[model samples]
Target: MRLSDGPVALRPLRMRDAQPWHDLRRENHTWLKPWEATRPVDETPEMSFANMVRRLRAEARAGRTMPFAITWSGTFIGQLTVSGITWGSLCGGHIGYWIDKGHAGRGVMPTAVALATDHALQTMGLHRVEICIRPENANSRRVVEKLGFREEGLRPAYLHIDGEWRDHLVYVITSEEIPGGLLNRWRATHGPLHA
Candidate 1:
């Protein structure tokens, strides 16, 4: 399923996107490296893009994840994933995303995130959605805060980032908190989503 708000859109990631994705990563290497996840020394080397896509696709098929390619004005700019989905007693999932540095501060990322969160909570019938951000990542933190996600707490050594374990501040929003929808709430304050 595709999710969108004006020019910002999230669609299923595909192998056909490898070239542009790699090019964007290469271009934004310096800008994104510090916030990007890295494998520990004990683990195997990073998987190839093809292999990574294959694995993510498998997870999507199993209903464990929704890996999406973020687009702005129909051009691929980044990625967003609704992962770690849980059902039954706990119907929830967390979101992770990144955007091309050129697209930063333009409201694209927030719109993409809101779209994904709405899809997870409204379309998929999930109860809650969370976004974990490095404490130092002011931009990322602002995205959720602007969307009205409450700051839950800090997670010590949450996930491996930039070759080291980094502390992340957890932000969460439950379906009951926004009966009118998060996107509507965000739009109410931010005006139009597109630049």
Candidate 2:
């Protein structure tokens, strides 16, 4: 699947994207390290980029996750995944993303998020979408804030990050919250996000 707004777009991650993806991650290591998820037990070894993408593709095929490679002006710059999806009585998923340090601001992440959230709720028939942000991550929090996601308290010691468990604030939005759709609301508030 692909979603775009001006220069920002999201597409299913592909194996051919390995080089750029690795290059960006290596270059932004310091900028992104603090927010990186780490394995606490080390029971399972870390996966290589190719292995990671293969596993994500398997999950995508199983309908458990939507792993997207974020692009700006058709250039790979980041990633966004709507994971932990559940069906039946509770149809929902949580989103996680990180962008290149150079594109940190300029409405790129917000537009990408809105596009993903809209696709999740509108096209995927999901009931709700959520994002969990580390309380100290003001940048990530700001993205959800700009999109008007409701603050739903905190998840203490939520997920392991930067080598330790971290507290995260839950932000959520349901289909009912944006009957007219999220991208429309984003455009209404922020205008076009070209360039």
What TM-score does candidate 2 reach?
0.98
Against the true structure, what is each candidate's TM-score?
A: 0.96, 0.98
TM-score of 1: 0.96
Tens-digit lDDT string for candidate 2 (79-192): 999999999989999999999999998999999999999999999999999999999999999999999999999999999999999999999999999999999998999999
Tens-digit lDDT string for candidate 1 (63-166): 89999999988899999999999999999999999999999998888888888888889889999899999999998998998888999999999999998999
Error of 1 at 181 (Å): 0.9
In Å, residue 63's CA in model 2 sits off its true spot by 0.8
Off by over 4 Å in 1: none
Q: What overall lDDT, based on C-alpha atoms, would model 1 receive against the true structure?
A: 0.91
